[model samples]
Target: MNGVSEVFSTILLTSIFLALVFMLLPFSYYTIMGSVAKTEYEYVKHGFYSIATYFPMIATGGEYSIDFPSQYTSRGYIETGRIDIYLNSSSQPTLSFPCMALTQGASVGGAPRGLLYGVDTYIVNDSRMIPRIYEYRDGNGLMIMTLDTCRLLLDVNIVPTGNYSGYYYVLTYYNLTISFRGSGSLRIEPVRMYTVYSNIGGNLWNITIVVSDYILGKSFSYSVIDLVKMGFGKEYAGIPFSLTIVVEELVVEV
Candidate 1:
């Protein structure tokens, strides 16, 4: 109290000393620490967002797996499992994906060359492309390729109602969640048979099939044809042609 001027001078000296210390610090050290902390924060935020958005997409993938049977084993675990992995690479993944198939002369050496990218699906209203097919092996070991022949038994191809060919058109599309209904043990692989022939009743024709699976048509329903058209209203007793039918996620027309 006796020396007000001296007290002001002492406070000013202390403040100047603190400012000088801050200025003398190495700028790089602060810069490095700040960058690291910022990166960490951003990573955590983006990770959370990705997790939320991707969960729905994975669910969509599962909905299509509903056809598998019960009691399967995987990864040393004796439990039913479903796989939904997101990928854009060539690596064979741990995810159990269903076999994707296309028509003849496209797939070679067990790999399919397709015209479109990403998930392949068909919609009926899209008249530009034909409908997809679903051919399950029949008792006679034939892939039934006539699903649309008798769809509702109305006036259509193969009149008077016939067995459904494995081929069909998806009347609509579903962007909804993909949910799989699984059952039997599920395994996936790629297999190809270049040319196969049938000798029924001494009939001769060239038959070729390409499939990608450990066990092709093991659980499928098939049908054998005694008579098939050879074009121009001429049918053959045994006309061997490579055939394929792929069952896909379908939504009925409203």
Candidate 2:
């Protein structure tokens, strides 16, 4: 009788131990998985925010390739209504990148206004407008575009004339990183020109350049002529005449 009782007690304790382990297994798994998922979400969020700030710093015209987590896909655009970047996400880990442009006065209308973040406003007048929209890709691939600078020169070789139709404007690029291809073309558009005499006058212009890259999401137009136009004509000709540009540099940010 004593032996039998001991055997029964041992059996009962073994069964109880197994039951307890089975009960706790699922709870342990649940806790671990939840923590892992939360970690992933936080990490991805940090990366998304970083992109919002980092992009504009390098958003000059050119091909760009950025590496992101394998699970996410992102695209970027410059808002014309206001100076901001709107990021769109389409994937498992959805997200958005939104922020003001590093440079200011980047509006749809080509009129020059305030400086963007204290940086000089480069594009001015009706000639060049804000780059309305653009996009990016996942897995950090490649971006290629033409980058150039529009310099307002008080003195240049351009002869001032009433008709001024006979003079051809040359746009020379300085920090150009990518080569021209496909339907890519450089065009000089006349925005507005005011002339006092032949050599003394102001001209507002819109310079447009086309870039072709599958990596880039869309085509955009913007200029830096306005930022450099400030404080120059204020000294000369009572009102001052400012409308001369020299293509200074060629390169885009990545």
Candidate 3:
């Protein structure tokens, strides 16, 4: 009986020791990887032209890919080059890889993609004054199709570990993640010279690109949709709202 008891105790001790070692192995591995991640700071170089860096948000659905805009490239446009990467997961894994680009300049209209966190106001569909009726207080029936045309006020770029501030709209809209195949041609250019404002100087929001040979014979048209206004609900819906838009149309525009 004593021999039997001694054998069982030896086996229990051995099992516990092995289990401890197994649990610790993974923790040590991740620690090593985290150390390597710190190097992300070593290469950050501030400039007028920057390749887009995407700190992906956890897909929450499935594996997907998004592109970075080339407006921040050398000359406010990148024909092609390296882009910062991040997965929309706790993985926080990052990569720098080569890519093609969609037009340039600050995002104005078209399919909403990538990290669109802070955007103030944008016109939905067209700013054209169409007639759509809304029953507001019975006799007070109103037309919503025509209101102060909420133009593309602004879409602040997302940065790594940086906080950007802008008006938050709880508007109902489409937020899209798209995939395209086959070579095609698309061009995005920003026209009209203008100035806007932020929390800082009222004169701070201005488009300062110097044009060599550009012309504005007369007027322009508005086709971009306002995702923020689309997301608007009863009084901004209790603050801290997200301006996530749906892809009413699925062609990516930057």
- lDDT tens per residue, model 2, 162-246: 8542222222222223222222122112222333213223242333322222222333333323222332232221222333333
Give candidate 2's TM-score: 0.29
- Misplaced by over 4 Å in model 3 are 40-254
The total number of steric clashes, by the backbone 3 Å criterion, in model 1 comes to: 36
Residues 1-254, candidate 1: write the lDDT tens digits: 65997899998999999888788666766666555544543333233233223423422342111122111111111111122221223244322324322211110122222222111221122222222223233344322221110110001122122553221111111211112223232222112222121122232222211112221212211112211321112344323322222222322110
Off by over 4 Å in 2: 62-254
Full-model lDDT, candidate 3: 0.26
Specify the poorest-scoring 10-residue window by lDDT in model 3: 142-151
**Per-model TM-score on C-alpha atoms:** 0.17, 0.29, 0.20
TM-score of 1: 0.17
Better of 2 and 3 by lDDT: 2
Task: For candidate 1, give the lDDT of residue 145.
Answer: 21
Candidate 2's displacement at residue 48, Å, is: 0.6
lDDT of candidates 1 onward, in order? 0.26, 0.30, 0.26
Best by lDDT: 2
Q: Write the per-residue lDDT of candidate 3 for residues 1-254, one digit (tens) a residue.
A: 99999999999999999999999999997775544332221111111012112111111121223333222221122222222222222133133222222322221222323222222222333222111111111122211010011122223232233464444322111222223342232212212222221122222212121111111112222111222223343333222222322111112222
Task: At residue 167, give the lDDT of candidate 2.
Answer: 27
lDDT of 1 at 172: 17
